[model samples]
Target: MKNLLTILLLTFCVSVSAQTTRKYSNEFMNIGVDAAALGMSNAVTAFSHDVNSGYWNPAGLVHIEDKQLALMHSSYFANIANYDYAAFAMPIDNNSAIGISLIRFAVDDILNTTQLIDDDGNINYDRISLFSTADYGVTFSYARKLPFEGLNYGINAKVIRRVIGDFANSWGFGLDAAIQFETRNEWKFGIMARDITTTFNSWAIDEEEFATVQDAVEGQNQELPETTELTIPKLQFGIAKKFIYRYDFSILTEVDLNIRFEENNDLISTSIASITPSFGFEVGYIDMIYLRGGVGNFQNELQLDNSEKVSFQPSIGIGFKYNCIQVDYAFTDIGDQSVALYSNVFSLKIDFSCFR
Candidate 1:
């Protein structure tokens, strides 16, 4: 049975990865949940070593010698949205580990008002209702170290669910694959295949109660004939090196390249135009306090004339560790924004082995 399940998973992943068609759905997957990674502009693909690695690069989970759990919460889009993430990783043996993670992104209590004829000619605002939209994902991940000392492979199987008020909903399933290589020195490299098997979200709508839902999009000049959205494959590459300055101080720098494959688009120009390269570095002092900063999502600025763009998204974070408890804080701007939509993430992690 175990062999059969493994074969089935591999087969499905291979089939989806081979698909060339493109679809952009469930964009919430791109949001960074790890405070440490977000602070460093999401450039931790090669050096991710915490429980949050279950989402970034599962291969990094093998680096956890003790059972660890991490929790994170953040507000996005100026507090209009709520996002929460949690992950727990358990080392199965010297060569294998497993993890589980969950993420929920939500916008709550939206006023649902409609334009309908009342008995009188006047508009009716008294009947307005409230609703909410939310996106959720649950993932199971596993990693194993290869025979070689520094080589590791990992995979994640996830299920996605999205709900719009109680009118419409969607369900999706996808897979991710990752590999990490660490040199004897302080250098590391990583490759992550997101949606390796293109993720397909199948949406359902109640035509009877929500017949106007389709018409609403049509009013905006969009077609709503299709109920399925296929997420194309995205590949990320990363490299990092750590420099030891003094006995108690060290610096780590990393960069990541993001590439997305489309079915019928210009592979080169589109890749170049759409890609958001990330660069970040971290400074550690005495192995207890750390400072991290990085820049990313510059594709728009890079393509436009310099005079047109004013602010580029940047992020900064600080971390403190004592024994088995670690706390991290990150401040970032999703884009050019005032105080209204500032993005801040906080994470707390604890290692269970400390108690054992």
Candidate 2:
């Protein structure tokens, strides 16, 4: 199993290097943060008002009432990989807010078998070792309300770091801009533009470590891998509304359109761009307990029989809020409607007012 895993990893790396433009570069950062937003299939772009908004729609940060802290954790691939997130947000003034967030995704303890077959064509179990691959991101965000009522704008500066044990590492930078608007009638709209400046990653590979695997496979690893990776811009547009049936009961519905400037398997694909639409709803009682559900990641997949079929991911979650603390739980798919098993995600949020 270890050897097979190593082969797979190397193959993936080679394939990525062969391509001039990778469609999924730095993909781990695309994974949604905050259990509540994940449960809603990331449909909260229009109304993500709190510390979590730093990762969703930074424009919502202006809605922060006070100092806030957030945390989340999830496991993927049956615990082979772990994803974690944390964030802090505070009101800088009456109409401005600032926040910082961090995210990490990692796969640890993978057996390195390149050295198993030592010099002289001898198999040596003692040569085996272990290593890990991990990706990290840090974002600084700021938001302020506009002079116009119910209008706000925000921006984010992101730093990305990736490591593959001692073999390779990279550093990247990017920027994002977003805006949110609300109407007197409670309808909301938002736009989030990610990688607006086209994120760039520069990698440094240890040639000595990589040399061990150069001959492990035929016609592969013949050249050094590409040192630069680029992530193009993506846009998300959202609209939402809330319906109150009484002072204590309410329902919120939202829709989001995600646009990528590439042709892919998304439900709506074209040579210029691809668009995927997601829908979600939340039901709340007395602002204390909540239930949420969503469907997203619509794709047209090719079957083994040369047929095409539509598939989507479905997610559900629950949340509880009391005073200044809130906890949320979600069951979601990390894959694009491909994985049979789902992952559980949990997140917590606390308002500093609780201490005062």
Candidate 3:
């Protein structure tokens, strides 16, 4: 009992200082909406009241008063990352809602190899295997209205997992939360906390760096002479605002932030620990459809060298809602290739009302 708490404290401190997201991005980057579209504004706006709220801002669910279901999928030409997601939500009361969401990230066709030491001072390479990662998880979300009439809040906790290959896999837990406020139905604001947990599964670790033949499998590191437990962080935040025009149109501007607490140089985040700030905007017509765009991760300016610095992930998307059914599509492009490396996503939702 004492030892577990100690390990958690260490992981939290390390994960909070100058945390780098590159290593973890590949494993779960596409967990949200249309990859191509999300890629455009630096993947901001997780605190959105749309089909993607399942992966973005779980608190956004409270705004959806009717029963709803949505699904999204993306295709990447580079094949570096690919995935699909589906979700459903239902309002339990005026101030509360419940939902379930699923996610899958797949990395296909990887080369596998084995390293061996030759007779003397040489080395031999053996082709051992090839595999990719198929990670999936189910999330349960609950949203409610705060005591304040204009305030709404939500919470989501998920059991996540990553299967590298048939030989090894790791599982952990994650959480997301959000709060939103409105005034006169013309101006709205939002705040959210993302990925507040560093998850772990049964895995192994070695004290001395040496060739290993004894693979005891699950949590092998637990029995080693001495091993340090691994953990991410418990912090991430975002802020946003929405505007409505007299012409019956609206616009939304948002900034999203994630902080990796890299308090110390550890195996998880030394090579790449930095803060990412993203920007996004959306224009809507009659509250039924919208034209959206966003640019993210910019410390100074936007330039032509988008490929190298990601001046900003620029995206354009459209959305439609009728009779409580809403659908949205966003195109994410970064000048990555001829096809533009875009993500295509669509979602279907249903809404119902009671005590009217």
How well is each residue in 242-341 modelled by candidate 2, as lDDT tens digits? 9998799999999999999999999999999999999999999999999999999999999999999999999999999999999999999746675656
| True lDDT of residue 313, candidate 2 | 92
**TM-score per model over all chains:** 0.83, 0.94, 0.66
Mind sharing the TM-score for model 1? 0.83
Q: Best candidate, TM-score-wise?
A: 2
Across residues 270-350, which tens digit of lDDT does each residue of candidate 1 receive?
633335578999999988999999986653222244443323468999999898998999998755532336788999999
lDDT of each: 0.77, 0.89, 0.57
Residue 339 accuracy (lDDT) in model 2: 60
Model 3: CA > 4 A from native: 1-31, 34-47, 77-80, 108-132, 184-186, 204-231, 234-239, 246-248, 263-274, 299-310, 336-342, 346-356
Q: Is candidate 1 or candidate 2 better by lDDT?
A: 2
In TM-score terms, candidate 3 sits at 0.66
lDDT of 3 by residue, 59-140 (tens): 7777775776677766666657667787888888877888888888777765433224334635546623466656677788
The order of the candidates by TM-score, greatest first, is: 2, 1, 3
Our model 3 lands, by Cα RMSD against the true structure, at: 9.6
Per candidate, the number of residue pairs that clash is: 1, 0, 18
